[model samples]
Target chain A: MKLEMKDSPGQLVAALTPISEYGGNIIAVIHQREPESPSDTLGVQIVLEIAQERLDALVAAIKVQGVSILRLGEERLLYRQSVIMIGHLIHTDIGDTIGRIDATGFAEVAELNVHMPAIAEPSTALITIKATTRSEMGRALDILRSVAAEKGLLIVEPLAGAEA
Target chain B: MRVAVLGLGAVGKGLLRMLAAKPEIGLVLTAVADSSSACIDPAGLDPAAILDTKCVTGRCGPSGLTASDVIDSGAYDVLVELTPTNAVTGEPALTHIRSALERGKHVVTSNKGPIAADHAGLAALAEDAGVALRYEATVGGAIPVIHAIRDGLAGNRFSSITGVLNGTCNYILTRMDDEGLTYEQALAEARELGYAEADPTYDVRGIDAAIKLVILANTCWNLGVTLDDIAITGIDGLTVDALRLAADQDCTIRLIGEVVPAENLLRVAPRVLPRNHPLVIEGTLNAVMLSTDMAGEVTLMGKGAGSVETASALIGDLIAIRDRYVECG
Candidate 1:
């Protein structure tokens, strides 16, 4: 979020205090003084990690500190997993396969890299899924497994903890 | 220690060759038998002469004698069962092991059939008769993993066991990743290189790896699950594009057999793993990762199958039994 506040001592701390109280983890705070003109109000950008439900509370609390809110942006998806699928991907309704994850609002297919050699030959795809949480990622993989089983496709999941 | 051997196949011949070379090991070959014939001598039979006979006449001894005859009333203290495996029935080897155990004789075997069939029952039978029943050659040949679980890591509780138990499937997958070959091409290479069998269904279909998981689960956790309980997914239908896709992400696929006791999970499938993962061994080498409480995760890697490699496991078990139970003359 971007905020415009008084260019004075203790005002930066006042704006940051409400972020923590409302369950927001502050990642970065950019506050620079311009060399050409010294403005009465200072512009600051704060990047934070917080759940969507708490963002409204955080915004209201920061406003109470007499700071004007400029803008708010969010990157919701945090967890991810990748799996390879092999079979007749296109013929088996590829759009529906991706829509299955998208329908689950918490998770979605982030990318689908398909390799199609011939029409009759079975196509292979690598699908990467992104989810809001770890449990939701598991649920997304479970949905992928069912879709594979139904479409006679082979799903090769990455070994858990292999990356570690 | 007087010892009797059954089944003069590749493993048997390799064992006899090793025992013949190392006489100071104190394991006297008292009786040896091929499928159709048996040779018994209370004063210890000659392994060198018997191997020569098997090579020449295609029989270890006269056809009048058989393996069951030796198991019933043989001049031996240890019975080494090396018969062909019928994973379903665990046939004649099961009965042979039972008889030997009942007679207060130590039993060691390379046959997964009998052990995978009735491990607890045979162990109980051996306990009742006061003898050790060892089958180190059964899974992960020459790795000594059974000993690591049952004795070396005895007090530690194993949470799970994950491994590449089948060598043929590993060979095929490794080739596919290295050469960009199709499944058929890799399998053909495996057959030409002697890694795959003429009928590759058992290895390629994941049954071989699942059978090994059953043995490990029964030994480690006493789960009592069989091959039927394992969910198997083979590498037969896997495509080259799948391997390439995995490679794009700096990963590779292997036929992994996982046994999680707490979850009652026994699964064999092709799973993507980081290229440098501990279980991502190449060629026909076998690797097992045992997750234990006290010891953390311990991995064992070695030759999974070969004439001499499996014989080495049988020999280790034999020496273990000799040092613990037998009276050396």
Candidate 2:
């Protein structure tokens, strides 16, 4: 998150202490100062990890410290998995297939590299999906499996290790 | 110790050749039977002569006798059953192994049928008869996975057994991935190389791998899962584009059989794995990864099947029986 607080001695510490109180881990604190520009407020960038449920309270707590929130960029999806799907993808409404995963709210179809052979031949696609957690990724795959089964398509999942 | 070998197929012939070559092992063949004939010599039959006759005439012994006759003759200390697997019924091999166990004779088999069909029943019969029933050649040929679980990792609890248990599927996938061959093209190449059968349905359809997984799952965790319990998705209609897609990410596809007893999950499917993963071995080679409490992850790789490779497993079991059971008598 980026923050703009009043340029003062204890203002930086005041902006940082509430973060730890809310059980957030501050990974890095970037304080960039410009020698040319004279501004009353200081620009600070913070990168941290916190539980999703505590994020709202964390933002409110930081705002109460007289710091104006510049921008909050939280990566909602962290877990990624890739699968291969084969069948008549275009004929089966490919948009609807991707739409189902995006509709899950916790997961989204990130990328798809499709290979189409001759006309009417079965098409193959490599689909990458990102989810908020491991179980959410699994649920997304389950959704894809049901969709594939309905469309007479074959879904190839990973023999997952920690790396896969 | 006296031993009788049933069936004169490649596995049977390979066992005889090993016995003939290794006189130091001191395994005396008392009776030998092919599908059409049986030869018994309580004084100890000659292994080379049996193989020679089998090679020349395609029949190992005299006519008008079946494998059952040799089993009832009671002329051997251990019965090595190596008949072709009957995936559905377990067949004559099942009855032969049961008869031997009932008669207080040690039974060792490379056949997956009887063991997959009725492992618990046969083991109980062996225990009641005070004999040993060992089928090390069932799952991963020459890999000694069953023995490793029963002995080396005896106390460790396995959470899952995942592996490329079928060679025909692996071979086809390997060729397709390496050379960019279509499924039919790779299968044709596999058949030409004798790595696949004419029918190929049993292997390509994942039924062969499922049988092996069922045998291991029942043996290790005693899940009582049969072939039907497994959710099988074979490599029969796999697209070459799938392999290329996997390759785009430095990954490849394999027909993996996985058994996670904790999840009550048994499945055989084409699973994606990294190129360097232990289970991503190429060709007809078999690989197994056992996740256990004590050992962490144990990966075993070896030849899945060959006449001599499977014969090696039979010999190990035979020698084990000799040292532990036969010699005591």
Candidate 1 chain B lowest-lDDT run of ten:
B258-267
| Tens-place lDDT digits, model 2, residues A38-139 | 588788999876656788999999889888889999987777899999999989999999999999988899999999988988999999999876767889
lDDT of 1 by residue, A121-141 (tens): 988899999986666788889
Per-residue error (Å), model 1, residue B265: 2.3
C-alpha lDDT values of all predictions = 0.91, 0.91
lDDT of 2 by residue, B31-106 (tens): 9998899999899998999999988988888898889889999999999998889999998899999999999999
TM-score per prediction, in order, is 0.87, 0.88
- Pairs of residues clashing in candidate 2: none
Query: DockQ (Cα-based) per candidate?
Result: 0.52, 0.54
